[model samples]
Target: MPDQIADPSDLRGDCAQCFGLCCVALPFARSTDFALDKPAGKPCPNLRGDHRCGIHADLREKGFTGCTVYDCFGAGQKVSQVTFGGQDWRTGTKEHARQMLDVFPVVRQLHELLWYLNEALGLSAARPVHADLRRALERTERLTRQTPQELAALDVAAHRQEVNVLLLRTSELARAGVAGKGGKGGKGGGKDRRGADLIGARLKGADLRGASLRGAYLIGADLTGADLRGADLIGADLRGADLTDADLTGAFFLTQPQLTAARGSAGTKLPESVTRPVHWTAGS
Candidate 1:
């Protein structure tokens, strides 16, 4: 099997092919992320008839920062087009709309796993488990294509657990040989900070090479100029975190959503997998 999937464009959200599912199917409470409360299955007031955000150009100015950070991992278009046969929720029956909404989240979760699996397969160091990752990816893609009823009835949590085991192994294999700056060998010399609560903590200029930061709460934390090469950032909450000038050159499992939610600058070196957030400043 090839080390990487042929194409990963399907793993990304494409709003043009979607039916505004995220705007309608997801709920949001009034907070710094959102400006108002919205119930599930209801359209956001900013949604236009064409299934585009009316405030797309000014989401941040309009107090919809959360909207800018969220990514459906291509689940929106899958549910909107493939699953529903291009059915528009606005024109569908209330029951149909509800079912679509319910299934959106389920497929979203699966697609997220697909994203991680795809990434894992691309890692040269993870070649030992590449075949398993490929199998998991194919299985996840099959699950995403299931009927809405099957999706709604799917035990996604159980599936996630199964996939996570492979991802954990992949992480171990990928990070095992990344020697830290201080001559520390093997997994960044014991910088295991998995699931740590570092909210609002100052970590500027810290060296976190090959560190395990999976499931860590880094909300509002200052990570400016940190050396994060080879770090595992799966499930890390980086909302409101400062990443100015941070060196994340070889970081793995750092999704676009997490990168977008944090603050950075043009000088912040990032891995090729994720793009630099537009909100990031031009200078360091």
Candidate 2:
């Protein structure tokens, strides 16, 4: 398995292969993440009559960068072709429409797992379980190709539990490699935070021990309950990020500017020189 996240640029997006499922099947709130509030089973306003984003060329201008970041990873095509036999929601009965909508989210989860599994397989450090990871990846890919009925009826939680066991092994292998060689990460030229936008990232319960997060943008990220023990957070932007219930015991080199940029609750533990954010006190 690979020691890092696979570059997401490798993913190909072809909505023609999909049934416009993401635009119809997913729910979103009117927040910074989404431009509008949409219910499940309803097509987004940006979705064109021809099953494409009407604002595709100007998503950033219209504040739909979150939509741009989302990648279905070909599961949309597999579900539309293999499961429903190329049937679109426009051609389906009410029951079929409901079924397709339900199955869409399931296939999306499977695709996300595929992403993680693919990443795990590229790590030379996970040699002990490289064979297992590859096998699991192939198996998951096959499951992703199942029909709508199979996908809709799948016990995804159980599959996720099974996959998580393998991911744990992968994490252990990679983290062990990081801990070796005196805790220096393999990336040459040290930590590169250039143009890194980590808004709303799930860093909760993350083991960021000894990590160099220099100049990284961590705005609105959830670091609640994170283990930041011994991390180097110099020059990182932490604006609007939540550190409530986080444990920063023994963390190192966290700058004042970084601390000032984040939000926290009273329960958040802190480094000696920095106090909690003002919002934390106001909210408390």
Candidate 3:
């Protein structure tokens, strides 16, 4: 075993080092997520001159709950320091602002891949492909460090597809250990519910370890105390899911956005990739 710690800087979001690109570049529609409608390239109304959210302390309380859960996987800093050399849009020209906004999402996609690849490395069962995963991580990291033009013109969707192949294999390797360990995962007619509309489904305390929940719409589902260890939750809509005490110790590909959207208490066991949402508390 390696004595070095597994912490990777690019995999975690450091809002302090960011230039608040997310608050300025990303557009938001007036919906359940945001309180107002803002077009692309326009800064949010609550953004301060210093790139700090003026309403950061009360985002969820004031109807901008979506902002609270958004993570750029350190893309903001990558664009701030490397792509644009730490120049803030506030001090840049119109073209610079436009270019920064354009490159933000591209770098974000690459950083997200880095996050997944880092997680895959820690899974013991995925050892067979760990070397490949490391290579992909390095390639993706290099892509994130490229100049603004190079990043903007990147074929991001194609790269995402290639990375997805590796992630799928990792999921299979990890979940195979749950074959008959009292888990109903990938069994019991537990049909692949990828992107299914299971909103508000009464799945409380369900035995779903190692199940594939990729892109499943579990919005507002009653999954309190469910066992989700080793489940594949990549792209799954966990917004509003009741995971009060759910065991997600080994859940794969679960992102900050999905967890932010859901309501989970302190008892909800999460993987190291994401942080516990502040809104999750007793009786939440």
Top-scoring candidate (lDDT): 1
Error of 2 at 207 (Å): 13
lDDT of 2 by residue, 1-284 (tens): 13333333323345778888888999989876588899998989888777788998787579775575565766677677767888888787989889888987887777667766665666565678877777777777778777667877889999877987786566555444233123555341122333467778998876665455545688889898776654445446776778887777644335444665566777788865355654366333
**Considering TM-score, which of the candidate structures 1 and 3 is the better prediction for this target?**
1
Residue 81's lDDT in candidate 3: 84
For model 3, residues 192-261, the per-residue Cα lDDT tens digits are 5567788889988988877778888898999999888878888898888899998898787888888988
Each candidate structure's count of clashing pairs? 0, 5, 1
Cα lDDT of model 1 by residue, 131-244, tens digit: 899899889999998998999999999999999999999888888866465454444333778899999989999888888889999999999999889889999999989999
Q: After superposition, how far is residue 166 of candidate 2 from its true place, in Å?
A: 1.0
Q: What is the alpha-carbon lDDT for the whole of candidate 3?
A: 0.83
lDDT of each: 0.89, 0.67, 0.83
What TM value does model 1 have?
A: 0.95
lDDT of 2 at 64: 72
List the pairs of residues colliding in candidate 2. 1-120, 1-123, 2-122, 2-123, 83-147
